[model samples]
Structure formats: structure tokens, C-alpha cells
Target: MKVAVHPDRRPSHEAEVIAFSYHRLALDLARHLGRDVNNWYCYAVWASKAVSENLDLSPGSCFLGDVAARLNVPVWLRRPFRRVFLALLGPSYPLALALANRAIFLEMGSLAAELWDADDDYLIRVDETGDFVRRPEFLSALLAPAEEEFLDAVVRLFTKARNATGPERAEFVLGANIALVAYEQQRAQRLLELVLNRPPRWLLQGSWRWLWCALRRRPFHRLAIYTAPHAELAWPARKAERWWVRFYTSRLMVMRTPVGRIQLGRPLPPPKGAAPETVWAPIQDLEVRELVDRFLPSDFDRATAGVGNWLSFDDRMRFIVAYFRMYANVPELFDPPFTSDKLDELEAEMDEGHVPEPYQEWLQKENARRAAAGRGVRGLIARQRYRSPFRSDPDAAALAGFDLTGCVHRRTLRPEAGPEALLCCGIDGELCGDAGGRCGRQA
Candidate 1:
């Protein structure tokens, strides 16, 4: 049999479809049991204040708007007047609209009241707290002892409807599933299985499992692991882990290497064997070249021409990290041509900061230049102890094993050295300090 196609289902549409299905099922059950059931109510309890504020009054607002639009006024005048009136009234406009369209508003309000009323007989409250009480005291008080049989019949009928083959079956099952959400979960599962002959595939899907775990108050880590293998390595999972680590472990250390960055439990002890005297390592020229090549030609020229000296340490660090991360993740996004001239220009810019200039004067000049070029002026300037000389001709073979140590060293690299220098440290202990020569203090 050919089934009618549905409109593309947005979140709201899915909700509405489920609600309509549940209402129909409730009506069918009432008719089957020879009892009068006026309305079915579905209440979604929100733990978040923000979510409650966004959703609770949405339907009422829509109802009010529909009522206002049907007010016999011409469409052109009506829309303009409505906007002006709403603008003037601010938060109180909904109340004013309800009052103006009392008849229609009241009718809509009555329907809403039936669905939202705590005293309604066929109420289903989904607890955000995850306590799916199958039969709350208030609900128990409303039903006679014998009426429990009617509820059983309702569940069985819903199960049958859920199992039937049709386009509507999925929607029917969804609605039935929600209605039975508060049921003793095991009993609901068995009844559904008896009718459908198998567990619903949706119940085992990732999104559904996530929702189920969330409702059951599972910890985020547990939820993450439950949903995906090696989820701890996933970005959001790592972020969640980091948040807890930051809260509990005050001394976590982050180390950057040639291969990848690593988070350590604590700072490493000093090298046991003979280590290199120079603590800081020189940044690979290839990395610097890559950064220059990644930049737009105009940006490359501007940055190379001492414009980088104008950028604050933080801005420089941010720009560098952003560039590298983008390059690593989506290299296709960048398509800039590399030129020897631009590299030479960058090398020229690096000459100005060989000897540290007066911090305030350098900042003033940078800010003035930025403002002259229609860019925002820098507010704060950080003092720099040393700056690296940029190499115009970077050796590709020499940089084959280049490792960007950490952000501390990257912040000190000369602008002409390119953005990648943000990851490398000086080898002469100029940046990190000498062994037993205040290296720990410098870090």
C-alpha cells in the first residue's frame, strides 16, 4: 500500500506528531474500555531555567499571534501595528494581546489547560530528574483499583498498534513509548517485546541511548564511554575530562612535542642522564615557511613588514594557534601562494626587535599604525625579554625532525620567524633559562 509522504520533520514537528499519536491512542483506549477520557496531557519537566523559559510559553505566544492575525484588520496595517505595539509594550505585550483577543485566546487557553493541568486524569509528566514514577500518589488517587485493568488493556492495544506495519507504525511506537515512559520499565519492555516480537532498534541507537543515560542521571564519562568506543579521546570527552582535572588537580602540566601535545599528571623531574646544556630548542624553518605560505599574500606582506611587532603577545599566540589548527584540520581552506620575496620581507621585519625596544613606545607605534590602517588599537602590551632572528632561507632538510615544545617558547619567537615559532623554544636557554640557573623559576 502506498503511504502518503510527510513534510520534513523538524524537532517541533516530531514532537507534535508524537503528541497527536498519543492523544489518538488515549482516545482509542478510552473508547475500548467504555469510559469517557476528555483530554491527554503531556508535561515535560525542565531542570534548566533557561530551557523552561524558552519552551513553556512558546505555544501560548503562537496561539496569541494566530488570534491577533485573525482580527479583521488588513494584513499590511495589522503587521506594522502589531510590531509597533509589541515594541512599546515589551514583556507585557503577550498579556495585552491575550486580553485583546480574549475569545480566541480563551479557547486556546482551555485546550492548553487540559494538556498542562496537574489535575488532569490522563497526564504524563516526563521528569528531567529521571525519576520515571510509573504511578505517582496523585495519579493513584484518581484511578479506582479496578481501573488498573483498563491501563493494562491500553498498554496491550498500544503494543499492537506499535507492531503493525505501515508508515504510521514508527510514529505510533514513538507515542506509545512516551506514554509508557513512566511504566515499570521491565514490564513495558516485555509487553512491547510480546507484541513487536523484538526490541525497537531506535531504543538501541546512539542518540536514544544518550537520552536514556542522561535521563537516568549517568555521569558524563560513563555516558561518553557507553555511546562510543575510545570516546575519552574525542574532543568533547577530552574537554569534559580536562574540566574535572582542572578542578581537582591544580598542578597538571601540558607538554608539546613534534608528534602531538600531551597532558601530564605533573611536571617531569630533571633529566637523569647527561642532557643538552641549552634548554630551549630552535624552531624548524620549515614550520615557519608553512605559516608564511598559509597567509594571504597581502597579510603575509603586511605581517612580514614589521606589522607583527604591532601584535601583542596574546594576539600573536592566538593567531598562530588558530592558523596551525585550521591548517591541520582543513588544509583545503587555505590556498595562498608562497614567494621568496614575502619571506625576505618577513626577515626584514625581524631586524627591528633584535635589541628589545622601549615597551611603551613600541606599543604606541604599533597601535597608531593599526588605527591608521582601519584596525582596532591594542589596549595592553606585554614586555618581551628576547626576540629571535628570522632566517630568509629556511633549510627543509634541517627541519625534518622539528618539534614545537610549548606555548611559552612560541610567545617569545620573533614575528619574522613566522606563526609556527609560537610552538618552539630557544636552545640556548635564553627563553627557559639555564640548567640550575633559574630555569624552573622562568617556567
Candidate 2:
């Protein structure tokens, strides 16, 4: 018999319906809310699900989630696994596991009571029953366990979040956004305030905070960017935004210039709504208290600890898997990349022919170019040639286009793919979101 079921009840993987709680759902939301390594690996797996592209998906992806659980990350992460030299990075394992734990929710599913809709008091028409029933009663039956039991868990989760205070509430805070609940208007506004750090009316040095808001696609809202990762971000989840992500195109001009400094399309700020406050989303894979005790940075006041042009990770092979520090909020996992030795040490290595051939050649020409330019002569390379409004680093789409207009779309991270608006179209039809998992499966 056919019955209306929410998309949340029918996960792409059947097991997901059973394992999913606010935890896994929050991780899913995080991917949609911001850009991370999961986007890259998930795209490859989804594009070739038939071909069985070698990549990770279930149980969580790298960095922001449970990448530590499976040390053998997908090839994309492996490609970036390097011995970056920086003192700021200490140990990656503790923090990697911390992020992984943050993605697990064994006890938070009870908040399902918030699923009740008092506004319209929906009625469900089950084909088998041939009768009308309260929407809450019908939908609650879709849960894996007793409706009341799940409601208890959900209530506890939401109450904890509503009652919590300070930065310690970040994990539950992220979970609140994704947890199945029907929040009152007042409660919703409060939740938004808890997650978002609204910059005061007063401005800052050089208007960096203002630019953060303007570029994030939310010109009206005056908010800041997350100083760290995963939370305090106001990413676009509108229908138009999703469509653009799936169909947005750009110009290809990689070959126009042989070599020179080229603009990378203004270097978008975290690719979404991010703020300056650093909040650590809790993880459950490891000892929650232990993870925070040992790995949490003692100082969050590093001068250069602010957002970087690109996120950096500390990669190392340890224990049963390779530990990585990719969470911008937790620099403790990064590698220590400073040395007090004399300047001649690095110069001596370069002089000893240790530099790669391409860089060595570039160096010789660069010095000659600088000298020639000083003398008012032509340099080895010409001016920078740029194309595309977002990025021009030769992505998968741009390479395939091989045309003047190298069109591209977001391979993953679509809004419908996350916790989003419900279609709620027909009374007799299934209570579906537009997704139906078709677009998600395609991505």
C-alpha cells in the first residue's frame, strides 16, 4: 500500500535511515552549509556510482566528519597528504577523531516531536486504510521505533541545545539546525542567533568584516565569518542558488597565457556565509571530554590564525590510519612548520641542486627577469591572463569543455541535498521534498 513518507524516512542507503540521528544529519548539513574535502570526494563517487568510482561516502568523509575512522581516505585527500612545515600544527589524530565523533548521534534522535505541524494540522490519507489521520500520527509511524521514544530523544536534544550556554554548545547547536523539529518563530530566531555571530553596528579595520558579508551572497545581512570551521556560517540554501550551483558556467582561458601570475576569481571567502567566532562542534567517535582536554588549543588568539586564502591541513601516517588536521578551528592538529636555523640552510639546499627542475628553472629565469625589468626590458613571461568569475585553476569541468566558455556546475553540495524546504505539495501525494533523491543520486 502506498503511504506518504518524508524524504528523511527514505535515505539513499537504507541503513542511513536506521543510523541517522541529528549527528549524521548535522554532518550532512555541514557539507551543504560549507565547502570541505567531502565535497571533492563525494562528487567523484556520485558521478561514477555505476562505474563504482573508488571513493568514500558512508560513515562520513574526511576532516569535518569521520575521515579518521577509515585512515585510508579517498585519493583526493591522499593527493594533499603532505609534510607541511609549520609549528602551529602539533598532532592531527586527537582532533581528527574529535571531528569524526561530532558526526555521530546515537542519542539525539528523540527530538522528532518537533516534527508535529500545528500551523496547518496536516491530514494523511493512507491508501491501505482509506481514511484520514493526523499528519503527526502518520509521520511518527514512519520512524524506526515507537513515536514517543523517538520524540523523547528529540526533545532531550532540543532542550539541551535551548538551555546550553557559551561556545560549548556548538555541536548541539549545529545539530539543532538539522534535527527534525518544528520550532516556533521565536525559537527559530533564537536558534539563528545562537549559531550566527552578528557583528555589532560598529565596523572594523579596513572593512574586512563588511566584505565577508557582501561576498557571501547575503548583501543585506551584516554578519561575520566563522573564525574556524563548520558553524557560524550563513551559506546560501535558496532554490536559485542551488540551480546556479548545478548549472553555473564560466570562461576557459588556461592556455591563453603560457605562464604568469593569474587572478583566481577574487578568491571567494570560504565559498559561503562564514563568521569570525571560533566554535568547536563536538564529536562522539572519541571520548568527548578527552578529545577536548588534550587536543583543544590553549590559545585562540594567534595573529595569523584567522581565515587563509586556502585551508591548510596537517597530514601524517599514525596508529592504524593516517591522521589529518584539516579543521580550521583546530590548528592543534596542523604540523609545526617553523625552524630557527640560519637562512643559509635553505639556500644551501637550493644551491646544492635539490630544488625541482621546474622551480629551479623558474628561479633562474625569475631572477634574470627581475634584473631585465629593472633595466626596462622584456621579461621571460607576459602579463596575467584571467577568465571565469569564480575560479580558473583548471577544474574537471573546464578541462572537459575545451572551449572559450568552459561551463561548470557544482558537482556536489546542492541545497536540496541537505536539510531544506519540504515540497508539501499534494494532500494525497507523498509528503516529499523536490529531491526524491534523484538530483542527489545524480550529483
Candidate 3:
């Protein structure tokens, strides 16, 4: 008999949110334990599966329960539960949610390892069994006794890759990271050496350069390399190098006039035509705009104009933080319109000080717009009508799009691909608020 392999199914939105909350908990655990673990993606997948298997509750439901438990609110509360809960927690919801979610994950302990080891197909199979009759047998086989040693080896390999420098260094680092998680240290090391000795045929293509750039610019780039080969370079020298790379990578725009690049502190004049409908649904509301304007400086436009047309990454983050800080107590302003995952991502970026400026600007605008419309902020990306490349169904085609890549739905999944094709698949789907069956994959 031929074993069938199905494409990995997308988790429901509630699963994504729960997974996200769990992921934050995992990150905290990793940091507190001083362990170098796999990325948030891995933790999230594990968390999603665990929640699905144990609770048989959607992520959203679990999140609400978690929140209620934290607030000492009864789960039996009905109708105005959310309203009353928000009123009780006020602006402290974010912090409270974080604590509650952390407590929930802490209850999992070593079982999280089993969830991480089990693949999606296996998890799905177990779930379909209803009572999870096959769980113990499958988990035993899935999680090897040597798993702890394997994790240690992975950290070691990453450390070694950090110190090693070659054309294939990045590839080796990525390969090693993946292999380590899969408990294949020898294969990971061989991959590193293979890249060092000979360039892969695919690397000859133009795509390799783009991949290299992406790898080098990643936030964790420095962590992958053990030693800085060019440690002697001064800060100014490093800054200049970064600027040149950015300039080379930036999309070039040709202008006829000899006008210099817009200086910091000057606002670009609004385009001549009607301002494109605000990208955010909330921004289009006159009332929200009025409210946002009130919080800003009297000469906000003029003062900000002096700063430049685009806000610096730090400034954009500051503005977002300021907005939330001011509106935290107002659920009408803070709660409904935004999803927990988006808010988590926003907070994460703020903590890391690497808020992607373009995405942040979109968030700020959308929050202001939502407030104006008497709606709470919902998700990181605003919902927009777009066609999913994966499905031909009219309804799926018209599903609201999320800006996962910060470029919106300029990309999508194909039928042959798995859920991994889309980085923001889980969170985006949840925030879109589509019912599970509505976005279900058609075989």
C-alpha cells in the first residue's frame, strides 16, 4: 500500500493567535533558560498543534478563556463578556495577556518537545482519531531519547558557523540550523563543508545574490557567525558599508529635476490627485482622523515636515508606542479593531528596536482610522479584497488580504505548496476573521 502525503493544512485563525501567544511564552522561556532554540515559527507550529489536541478549542476561544482566568472573570459570563472584561482589565490587557499565556505554556513543560518533534501530517492523523488513541505510540517514536543531545549539537553547530567565513557561510548556517532541529547534526556539518568546498549549481543563478543579501541583512545575522572577521572596522566604516549596500539594493527612481533627495524634517507634498483612499479602513473615517489629530502636536504636520517625508524606524516605533500608551485605557480605541498577534508583533518590534518602518506606518494609520470609526485595532495588516493564487473559488478569491511580507498579497500559495509557503499564513488568516470552513483548502 502506498502511504499518502497530503499538503499541510492551514491552522484556523484562533489556532494562530493561540500559537502566537504561546510563541511569546516560548521566547521568554528560551531567554530565561539561556538556551539557543529554534525560531518563533517552530514554536508556533508546536503550540498550535498542542492547543488543537489538548483543548479541542480554537485559539481565539483559548485566548479569551486565558484572559478571563487571568482577570478572575468567570468563563460562564455571556453576552457582554468581552465588553465587561475589557472594562475590567482596561489598558492592562496586553501585559495581562502576556502573563496568562506564559502561565499556560509553562504548564506544558517537556510535552512541548513532543509537539515540536511531531510533523503536521502525524498531528493531523492523531487529531482525526478523536480520542488521540495513537498519540502515545506516535509521540514515543517521534521524540527520540537523544533529543536533548541533538539540541545541544545544534547550538554548537550554530556557534561554529558564526566563526566560519566563506562564500557558502550563510547557506551552511541555515542548513545547520534546520538540520539541528531535525536531529541531523552530521548531515548539517556535511552541508556546511559541501557549501564551503563547492558552490551549489543553483547558486550560479542570479537568485543566490538576493539570498545572500537577505541572509546578511537579517536581524540574527551576527548571531549566526561566531566571530566578526572585520571586527577592526570602526562604527562609521560599518555604517558607511551598510548605507552603500542599502543604496545598491534600493529601487532607483529617475527624476528630471536636479532636486536633492528630500531632506529630513520636510514633508513631501501630498500628491496632486485625490489622496488615494487611505490604505486603512479606519483612516477613512473622519471622526478617527479628528481624534488622532487631537493627540498630535498643533503643528504636527509642520513639525514632522522638518523630520522628512518618511519617519525613521525609531521615530515610527515611538509614535506607535505613544499612540498605544495614550489609548490603552480606552477599549473603544485599543481593543476590538486589532488582533492580539499584530499587537504582539508590534510590541516585539518595539522591544527589539527593529520595527520595519513601512509596516509601522501602516499600523499607525490603520489604528488611527479604526479609532475614528469607533472600531478597535484588529490586526497588523488591514483587510483588502484579493485573489488567493492557491484557490479558484470565488469566495476564497475575494478573501481579505494581509500584508505579511510587508508587500501585501503580491505573492501567494500554490496548490502544490504547503502552508509554509506563506510566512504569515496562520496569523493573517486568524486576523482576517474568516470562519474555518470558508478558507478551507479544496482538494
Candidate 4:
């Protein structure tokens, strides 16, 4: 029988083709992702902030305009010119790349020379141990030959392109390149695992996951070895046994003694008629994973905003809390319920010693009515007493990750208490210690 060609079956046959399109879309996309890094206008905001901090220069109230004018080079020319500017200012490009590691900022030393279009002979000084490799040369040598070549080529291309653009353009292009490189590196690693170990069918559909697979050299196993009780052990079987399992077989075999397997605990007798359960369910549901994926990025963004880097411990905790909040809707995940009216009412209530006689009598009568009916009056009265979002001491203690016993003194103490007296209870240590430093200290 003659068969018709299905559009989806042919990998080479694209759904739509561009006319006179000589360029490969992948290459063009990669180039575009790299080139748009440093937008000059964005750099000006940073440069403006940098100049504003310089009180000694005293640009005055018009300092922003002066900084803009002083640094206003075309985007294309900005790269090479900024190199000269920074060199003249005494802070080199390497210095800036060594400090910044976020989406917006990069450290001086961590910056690649390709970023500046400087001579390839440029060297970064390294000390003993070599644990922290800063220079592109060192990194290039350490990475796989293909990766090193690709990276160096990219650096060379950007450096060459730098001369064609202004200082502002150079910075923006470099910024775009930096973001793209970080993103691609992440993608390549993820894709490599995916190809090598065959992930679940569902993961391949997502835009982000597909991007990862495109960049990675191998696919990884989606389900873990510890997925549920008995799911037939999702593995490539023999190949995995030789490649990844043999290294630790001796320890695993130790549990397989003559008496009984460590986990067997005397095998149950097989039933003559009963059939084994067939359907398998994953321990972690797809919904939980989706929720976690959605919430975790926002938490990371929040942490990055509060602190310089997203790798800090507090930032990790913030991400964990955000994940758990989506995992299970718990009140402790949120801040004290804050309402403007409740705050105003609390302030008003504090101003007066007692409610009007009529109001007080009515409250007493209601409390008596509730008590006479055998329904609790205390809870009802307490509910009416506080404003919405007004957290009790217990709730506040839970939110701050402290036991009620540890915060007994805080309950008795008023907000007006002196800092010294308040901290005398050692709640400083109990509370996440100077919010910014807490994560750093843990790290």
C-alpha cells in the first residue's frame, strides 16, 4: 500500500520554512542570546548608582545628569571605552567580575577576557591550592576539550565584536553573553543527564526541559532508586550495573547474608490464590513537582534581591519554605496577618482605658449568654478582641522558628522595651540573626 508522509514524522522537514534563510536558526538564536547581554541604558542605572555613592566627587543634586553625560558612550563603543575608563579609574574588569554573580552584576576577576576584547595574553594571578580557579585559561584547561574550544571561541567572538560597538554597547553585549553562557551551561548539563538516563515521558514536553535536553549530551533517569516500595527498579539494567553500580556492589552485597537479606525480615509465605497488586503510584505526585517548580524560582529571585547571591543558606531556606507552602498550605509560611484597619483599631483601643459602659455591659451579657448555652465564651471573646492578621505570641514565635518556652520573656515584654532589655532573653540568636548575615553565617 502507498503511504502518505506525516508532517510530524520527519525531523528534517520543518512545519514552516523562511524564504532566503541562509542562516541556521540554532546558531542565530545562540548568537542573539549572547549579544544582547549588556544593554547600555541598564548599565547607566548601575553607573548612576555608582556615581551617586561617591560623595567626595559631590556632583550635587544634578549628579545623575552629570554621571549620565560623563558615561554616555554609544552602546556599541561602550565595551572598549569602559575598559579604558575602568583601567584609568584603577578598578580593572577582573576586579568587577570577581564580585558580581547575579543576573545583573558580575565580579571583576570572574569576568572572561573575551568580555573586554583585550589581548589573549592577559593573565589572572592564582595562589596556592588552585581550588578557586578564576582565569578563563585555567577553566578552559580544566573543562572537556569540546567545551573549552566552544567557550574560548565564544569569548574570542565577543571580544572581536566588542571593538565594533561603543562602551555602552560592549557592556550590554557582555551582560547578555554572561546571562546566555550561564543559561547554556545549565542547559547542557541538564540535557546530558536526560539523554544518558532516559527521563519520564512527561518531562520532555516542557519548554525548559526541552531546552535542557537540546543542550545536554545525555539524558538522566527521572525517577530515583528510592521511588516507592517496588516499582520494578527503573534502570537501563545491565549497562547501569556495569557503569554506575559496580563501584559500590561490595557494600550492597554485605546486606545479602546467608541468614536473610537485611531488609527481608523473614519472607512471607506465598498465597495460593491471591494476585499481586499491579498498579504503581509515584510517591511524589506531578502536582507537587509542578507547584514546587513554580514557587522555588520566585523564592530564589526574592533571595537574590535581598542578598547578592542566591546560594546563601537563608536564601535556600526561603526557597524551602516557599516549596513547603505550596506542598502543604500552612499559616506559618506567611507573615503576621497585616491589615491597616486592625492596626488602627489596636492604636485606638490602646488610647482608651475602657469601652463605654453600654458596650462593656453588652459584651458581658453576650459572654454570659454563650456560657449559659455551654458554648465556650473565652474563644468568642478572644476572636472579637483582636484585629485580623494580628498574630498572637505563639503564632509569632512559630513564624520566627522559636519554641513558645524560649520566647516566654518576649510575651511579657512590650514593643516599647529597650533594645538591650528585649535582647536580654537571647531571642537575637533564636531569631534568624541579622537577616542578611544569617544565611552567610550558615554558608
Put down candidate 4 lDDT per residue, 1-443, tens digits, no spaces.
00011111111111001100111222233243333332222222222223223211122323223333445656566556544533232211111111111111111112231233343322121111233222222221111111111223234434444444443333323323332233223222322222222222222222245346446833422122211112243444434423432222212111111122221112121223322221011113232232233223433334222221122223333333232222121112121122456435433432332211111112223333444445367656555553211122122112122111111111011212221222122121123334221222210
Q: How do these models rank on lDDT, best leading?
A: 3, 1, 4, 2
- Each prediction's Cα lDDT score? 0.26, 0.22, 0.28, 0.25
Question: In candidate 3, where is summed lDDT lowest over 10 consecutive residues?
Answer: 1-10
TM-score per candidate? 0.17, 0.18, 0.19, 0.17
lDDT of 1 by residue, 1-443 (tens): 00001222221222233333333334443342222111122111110111112112333444234334544456557566555533322221221111112211112123323432254323222111222222222211111111111223223334444345442332332232222221222122221111121111222333456467557855322112221322325565544443433432222122232223322233222222313232112223343223233331323223222212111222222233222222221211111111357435433432333221111112223323433455233222222211110111111111111111100010111112222222232222123333322222311
- Clash counts for the predictions, in order: 5, 25, 23, 46
Put down candidate 2 lDDT per residue, 1-443, tens digits, no spaces: 00011111111221222222222333443332332222111211111221111112223332222222234555565434322211111111111211111111112221121223333212111111222222122211111111111122233333444455443343333333222221211112221221221111112211464356456744422111211222322353223222322221111100001112111112112212224342323354222232232223433332213222111111001100101112223211111111335223322322232211111111223323444554223332322322221122122112111110111111111212222122122112122234432222110
Output the number of the lDDT-best candidate.
3
- The true-structure Cα RMSD of candidate 1 reads 36.8
Q: After superposition on all CA atoms, what RMSD does each candidate show versus the true structure? A: 36.8, 25.9, 26.4, 32.8
Score residue 321 of candidate 2 by CA lDDT: 11
Which sections of candidate 3 miss by over 4 Å?
1-18, 21-144, 164-167, 184-342, 345-443
Compared with the true structure, model 2 gives a TM-score of: 0.18
Please give the TM-score that candidate 3 achieves against the real structure.
0.19
Clashing pairs in 1: 280-426, 280-427, 281-426, 281-427, 410-422
The positional error of residue 32 in candidate 3, measured at the CA in angstroms, is: 18
